[model samples]
Target: MAAPTPVRRGAARHSELFDALVELLLTEGFAHLTLDDVAARLRCSKRTLYTLAGSKEQLVRAAVVRFFARATERVEAAVAACATPADRVAAYLRAVAAELAPASARFVDDMAAFPPAAEVYARNTAAAARRVGELIGEGVAAGDFRDVPVSFAAEMVTATMVAIQQRRIAGATGLADAEAYEALATLLLHGLARDPATPARPSAGCRS
Candidate 1:
């Protein structure tokens, strides 16, 4: 496989300002956060803020990057802990289902409500897709997933989850329980379950 590309960094790369902006954005929404407010939160000057990350948009993008970076760490750690490939994939999705934060949901809504924000979100989401695809490839290597196109299957799972997240952001989180078992069950029915032994566990249905 070819090497994945990397993203470039911009001015105003101070980690402190980056974090403050993310927190403010999370609590106040990007629409309400201002550079001045961010400076105040960080006990810094407007000069310091501008010297580092530039406009609110840049700061916001940095925040998104930081958020996903941290999330990658957590999800990777979760995926690594499972005993088998099937279990790892299950653990990975479950971790994603469980990782939704109100701030993340709010960010999704705010971005969809505004065009430029939507573009930033699109870039971030594309990066996220590659990460998810890598996880699926790992599962395939372990013989826990069907021998199919990893990127496409990964995309299917990623797109479905994005739809779920968007619905959650829109206050239309359709399920009664956030456990996401219904989707999990659906995946199993569609033969996403890689471990043949998995269905045999009391949850068995349609096992021949």
Candidate 2:
């Protein structure tokens, strides 16, 4: 991907501010957080914050989009490091879990409260679902998984992801998002498991 537009004068300071803002969002959630709160936390003025974006909502939106962009990079890297399709699938989910592990219940609720942030998160979810579909296709082609219909399986996993994000299953089962993702990896792969007696081949369509 191309580089993102510069947000501030110094790259280092910009990164620091983004990280601090993310921490605040994760701790306090977006609903109750204010421009003043961000300024106070960063030891800066509201004017200084404004230099980054036009308004409070815009600032948060930019930060959230940046955060998810970085997360996607990390997840892609993690998946690429694996040798097999099964491993790639596991790596992808595990990387996602790690990225989301810091998010608390309040943080997720806050994202729902903010439309811009919610939209960014929803886009991330859609991308993840597509990636999962690709991995499943690779596994099946490599004889590592069953011959499940790619579209149907992908939608099923995507629907489950949406449920997980909405906290529907998590609220009822008391599972954190990260835990839910791990469980999903296990459940999907186990259900599609191929016999160990057969030799597995690398998928030509999948690169790691």
**TM-score for each of the candidates:** 0.64, 0.87
**CA-only RMSD, every prediction:** 8.9, 4.6
Compute the lDDT of residue 7 as modeled in candidate 1: 26
Q: Model 2: which residue pairs collide?
A: none
Mind giving the per-residue lDDT tens digits that candidate 2 earns over 78-133? 88878888888888888899988888888887787788988889889989999999
Q: After superposition, how far is residue 20 of candidate 2 from its true place, in Å?
A: 1.6
Total clashes in model 1, counting residue pairs 3 or more apart in sequence or in different chains = 3
Those runs of model 1 whose alpha carbons end farther than 4 Å from true positions after fitting are: 1-13, 102-104, 114-117, 130-134, 137-141, 145-152, 164-191, 194-208
CA lDDT for candidate 1:
0.60
Worst 10 residues of 2 by lDDT: 199-208
Name the TM-score of candidate 1. Answer: 0.64
